[model samples]
Target: SPRFIALCPTTLSSSSSSGAVDEEEQRLRSDLRERFLRTLLLMTDKQVEFNMHEKVRVRARFGASDIDVLNFQVSGLETPLGVQKEALLRCQDVISCSFEL
Candidate 1:
């Protein structure tokens, strides 16, 4: 699916949005959440999602500033009953990169 191709985290972060933290990161994160929900939609009879909370931990590059992101949806799909193996990778703090989206 075309959307699946857009699922590439790096691509979405670098190409789809502007900047790393403000746009790229957030868009990519939300996209992943939506994809997960879409899959669940195909499985369950009714809508079965209320929110999506993702805890992202990032390290500092050259300095001593860390980006620890605590993302949670106030209103959305309900959290899945059990979270077993989550395929998630946290992108550490922005160090010395000039990525202007």
Candidate 2:
């Protein structure tokens, strides 16, 4: 999967000659991916503010992301021009996103 590959380091260190280190690295990557997915789940249906490139910022109801995490589906997106009832934001363009607990 591209997502899994993207989450991993492209190269291994010289010390990674041991299988144990490879296993540990894989475990850590799995843990990180799980935590990220959990955070996204917690953000579901909540109001989220997304800070994007070019200093663009928008607020919208958080929706689901694709399996690849390449895009986000949102509702009531308030852009500088006007409010968009629904929109898909590319993850590459987004710098960060946040929501209140």
Candidate 3:
């Protein structure tokens, strides 16, 4: 196995130590979270397609997601055997999900 070695400094120096950095970080996090929540709200009752690892894919009607975003509650989940009335899908199992904007 070949390993690459760093030839330069790997860290950058920062001088700003005020609370401004914390405030800005919080603001950005809040804004991003708000956008994500709005997207979830809009996706409710709409069809969504999920792509999982190992080339597995599924389609379901969006219902809701947990606060931690660890799981999603969906309805009419299509499986290989049949459609499930309702199901909870682990977020970690999903590689990506998509819906019409």
Candidate 4:
């Protein structure tokens, strides 16, 4: 018991360690969110290609996305059957998406 107590971290040290970890996690989250927002801004009105499951691919003009990333709003969507003026594509159906510079 004495050896275990000596090996265990003190309350203050443990709290500091937890605080450092939380700070690091917050920093990473903020960085990622900023980058994603920038990417969305750059993608506005640009031509984007969406690759979906079952080998289905489509091209559309980037409009916007919901805050939760659940759906994407696109314009001039080109599909196999026909073209859609505007449509909302569910993120769940998409495998990947890309755009050119």
Q: Candidate 3: deviation at residue 100, Å?
A: 1.1
What's the residue-level lDDT of 80 in candidate 2? 87
- Best first by lDDT, ranked: 2, 4, 3, 1
Model 2, range 51-88, lDDT digits (tens) per residue? 99999989999999997889999999999899999999
Task: Note the residue pairs that clash in candidate 1.
Answer: 49-77, 49-78, 50-76, 50-77, 50-78, 51-76, 51-77
Give me the candidate number with maximum lDDT: 2
lDDT of 4 by residue, 1-101 (tens): 65445544453356565877666766786899899989988998999999998899999999999866789999999999999999999999999999999
Better of 1 and 3 by lDDT: 3
Error of 4 at 7 (Å): 33
> lDDT value for candidate 4?
0.86
**Poorly placed runs, candidate 1 (over 4 Å):** 1-20, 46-101
Query: Between which residue pairs do clashes occur in model 4?
Result: none
Would you list the rank order by TM-score, best first?
A: 2, 4, 3, 1
Hey, what RMSD does candidate 2 come out at?
2.7
RMSD of every prediction? 17.9, 2.7, 8.2, 10.1
After superposition, which runs of candidate 3 have C-alpha atoms over 4 Å from their true positions?
1-16
> Which candidate leads in TM-score?
2
